[model samples]
Target: MAGKRKTKASKAKQDDLAKPSKWRLQHGAFSGPIRAADPETGTPVQHRRAVDTLGMMLASGSITAQMHEAGEIFRGLFRAACFDSMSTSQLLRIPGSRVDTLSTMQIEARRRVAAALDLLGGHESPCGSCAWFVVGLEFSVREWSMRQGWAGRTVHGPVGQGILVGTLGTLAMHFGLTPRAKAA
Candidate 1:
């Protein structure tokens, strides 16, 4: 052989690098065989079965389309409010202090988020408790569960996720995005 041969593990990794990723895990639930990636690095990984929370829930019939829309809207608002900007404020250029500023829309978005939080009640409220974590931070159910447990909270897997779903429903109602019920 003119050069070093490819080891079985290396060959296997190369083969596994391009697999499609549809499978997901939520609170230890499993699904796909998609291509994986190193969590810390962007390099290709192998044999990853993790999936996104909202997509998996929609596909698995765990959440309704309206709920999904609501969740997405909430996530969108959070993303927008964050991405819209908060550069330094010149209105108060008294010194070298960097005064953060936001546009009217971003302010409105933050207000809306505040209103949404109010609608969800407080940090102690069941639905409200997990809303920010799941919607804003986008934690997976398993991660949320672990975090809650670590925080000295009672963390039932299904119930925790249910609270998140319920919060999305509440958001949908707040946004007027909920679909009216069809008559039987």
Candidate 2:
């Protein structure tokens, strides 16, 4: 007898939960209370079915237009990504700033590559944070190389390379220097 009562109570609760709330439909449709009776003639104004509203929208071409707009946006994004990749590739090539002999140039290149990696992978570069240090080193190296004429030993393009190397080394050294106040 007790088991039967428990089963009946559970069944009643399940049925209540399964029933859709009338308040949801009423409040969702309009601000005021909904009525089947027409205000002017007291005749019934038949409420259109939910499926009919969807069918009408589809028939009117609005849904298709929305879909077309969505497709266009996706296509535009895809093309834009392709263009960005191609430009980035060109910027990283043989004569680009990254390949320059200046240490600052290398640092700048690293920064750009890190940014591109982040854009592609949604992560920051570890080396990016230390780029300033690299700049200082490059500057110092270039200065030392120039003072020493290190390029003279090289077989080809020694003069130009020594200038490049020395300049970068000097810049790197300048970056690392801590300024001391001038004596009066």
Candidate 3:
């Protein structure tokens, strides 16, 4: 995005980052030695950006290792199944037997996605929000609840958060990422 691209000077402090700066940098949500190209000269620029949310959540103990693993798998499967399929011409409408063109791996990925949805109780399930909050960075639960008419109430914020946590927990269990209880 144009807004994300930082030029020579802007709100992001410009420094002679490496003539080079060897020190590791970590500020709030941002982390560095990111290798980016200067928009103007195409020179590699060492930069920092707000880093991984999943990692932050993991570090903060908001989610377990199992939850993180499940989230990673959920994200990886969807990414692997990206739009690599062939499309026929608009004028060429063949009446013959249609053939499935997706690769075995792609098909398997799609199956896994369906499995994930099934475990989450389908797209309409409140746990489906984990696919957004855990894997995707669309919005926070607070923002979601506000739009869903859970606004202004004292009970709603924690309720929404609990839903998200429960969602991640469900996924972890479904994927067998959770540890078993002690054998009696």
Of candidates 3 and 1, the better by lDDT: 1
Spell out the clash pairs found in candidate 1.
20-34, 23-32, 24-51
Clashing residue pairs for model 3: none
- The number of residue pairs in model 3 that clash at the backbone is 0
Q: List ranges where model 3 is wrong by over 4 Å.
A: 1-28, 34-49, 83-101, 132-139, 146-156, 180-184
Residue-level lDDT tens digits of model 1 in 1-184: 5998876665433333354423422234545555768789989865645456887888989888877888888777777678434555476467765456567887777777777888899656666657667877688776776667534676878877887777877777777876445211
Model 1 worst lDDT window (10 residues): 19-28
Candidate 2 residues 1-184, lDDT tens each? 4564444445433334333357656533322333489889999765433322213333555333333332233223333333223222444456445532335544554554444334323222222211221122222322333333223552233443333333223222333332223110
Expressed as tens digits, the lDDT of each residue in 154-177 for candidate 3 is: 327767767766777776777777
Candidate 1's C-alpha runs over 4 A off are 1-50, 83-99, 149-152, 179-184
Clashes of 2: 17
Lowest summed lDDT across 10 adjacent residues in model 2 is found at 125-134
Score each candidate by Cα lDDT. 0.70, 0.33, 0.64
Q: Once model 2 is optimally superposed onto the true structure by TM-score, how far is the C-alpha of residue 55 displaced, in angstroms?
A: 22
Query: Against the hidden true structure, what lDDT does model 1 obtain?
Result: 0.70
